[model samples]
Target: MENILEASGLTKRFHGLVAVHDVSVQLRRGEILGLIGPNGAGKTTLVDMVNGTLEPNAGDLVFEGRSVRGLPAYRRAHLGIGRTFQIMKPFPGMSVLENASIGALFGTNGGERSIGRAREQARECLAFVGLGRRIAQRADALGGPDRKRLELARALAMRPRLLLLDEVMAGLNHVEIEEVIEDIKKVRDQGISILVIEHVMKAITSLSDRVFVLHHGEKIVEGSCGEVLRDPRVVEAYLGRRRR
Candidate 1:
């Protein structure tokens, strides 16, 4: 498979503190890569840089074999990059369908220009995420699990070639997490590449083709799930963390 994204020597700093350091990663077409790290490991920062929400202090980003380092977030989105937030951002007063419709209207390559078409696309995405019955409900009225599904549906509505999911399973119950895992698998089957940041080991192991681990803003390990999970450094980091 061809690489859809290649980030090399990526770094980020916040007021003299390094949030991410000299990280390099790749995402191949139709592959799912899991990003795992303890809190403050800079996983979200890395995702932010990739999606253009934060500028990397150094390094280059290549998407579809072209440098996207200087592109704005919208331009990257137009280039077929879509992402969900760790914190859900729902548009209050808008119904779930309306909230998702915005993604279809403004996503990749100007998205669906016609409002009617965008709504249709949005409804399709919502139904795919099992939110078909909740389409008319106000966005903010949804519970935690539903909110996560809404986030996924919104991103899916973008018809992204590459999707960055930031903790979509966070706070979800086991059943909800399983459902999302299945939904994500279906998405990958549709040929979308995904870079998912998840702390849920079961979900990550099941979804990822490979796993990358970060510690204190540094890339400590990268390998298949079994290899990385059993690495001494990874074990030590988590073990030390649990004792803290």
Candidate 2:
């Protein structure tokens, strides 16, 4: 399958601190690639560079066969790159539906030109993320899991071909996490590729087609879920030294 997104020799620096160093990865069409690592691994920085929220000091980023190195965030979104932040940033005062409508209004292909059309698309996205019933509620009214759903809904409303999800399951309980896992499957079924950065080992192992491990701002391993999970380096880096 063709790659939907590619990053080569990607590097980022902030005030002499190298946050990401010579990292490279690819996301294939219709695939879920999980990025896992301990805190301060530069996973979020890599995502930001790919999604155009940050500029890389070196390397190239290609999406859909074109270079997106200098594109602004909104331009990237218009090109079918959508992402949810680790910290969910819903418009607190807006209703759930209204927040999603913003995505439909400014997303791919210049988004919807009419409020009615945007609202219709937003409603469908909300329904897809199991938030249809909460459309009339204020976004701030939702608890943790539902807030994550609202974030997902907002991104899906953009009609992206590639979605970058950052720790969407961060604070959910077991049952809620399972529901999110299912919802992600549904999203993938709709022909969208996903690159997820997660700390939850169980969820990442279960959902990822392949896993990439990062340590100290560099990629240490990339392989099938089983292979990556069992890697000694990965285990040591994140799971700590093994017991005898």
Candidate 3:
């Protein structure tokens, strides 16, 4: 399969600390690549680099066969890259439809130009993420799961070819997670490739075509879900050795 996004030897540093180091990853078109690691393992740092929120200290990011390392976040978004934040903060005093419409107004290919058209797009995206009933509700008034849905809907409104999901299921119950899993599958079915970072093991196991593990700012392993999960390296990283 063709790759929609590629990061080779990507590195990021803040002052004396290296947040990510020589980590490489690829998201194949229509595939969901799960990014997993313990806290401070650089998963979000990697996503930040890919989406242009942070410039890499070294290496390159390629999207659809071209280097986008020099582009700004908005430029990358217009180039078909969309991302959700680990910390969900909806626009204050804005309706859910209006919040999602922001994405439609500033999305891939410059998004929809007309406010009317953007709202229409937003509605479609909202409904797709099971938020149709709450479109008129204030964005900040929605609870945890619904806020997550709003975030997904906003990203979807961008019509992204590649979506970076940063812990979208962080605070959901089993049923809510299952609902999100299905929603994500539907997104993939629509041909959007995904790089999903999650602490939710069940969601990762169910959604990812492959899993990439990071540790101490480096690539520890990358393989099928079962293989990577069972690897000694991943096991040790997530859970300390059993005292024997």
Clashing pairs in 1: none
The reply for model 2, stretches above 4 Å from the true place, is: 241-244
- Give every collision pair in model 3: none
Instruction: Name the runs in model 1 displaced over 4 angstroms.
Output: 241-244
Q: 41 in model 2: Cα distance from truth in Å? A: 0.6
- Look at candidate 2 and tell me the lDDT of residue 32: 96
Candidate 2's C-alpha lDDT? 0.92
lDDT of 1 by residue, 99-133 (tens): 99988987999788999999999999999999999
Across 1-244, the per-residue lDDT of candidate 3 in tens digits comes to 8999889999999999999999888889999999999999998999999989999999999999999988999999999999998888999799999999999999999889999999999999999888999999999999988999999999999999999999999889989999999999999998999999999999999999999999999999999999999999999999977789
Root-mean-square deviation of each candidate, in angstroms?
A: 1.6, 1.4, 0.9
Write the number of the candidate with greater TM-score, choosing between 1 and 2: 1
Error of 3 at 146 (Å): 1.2
In candidate 3, position 96 carries an lDDT of 99
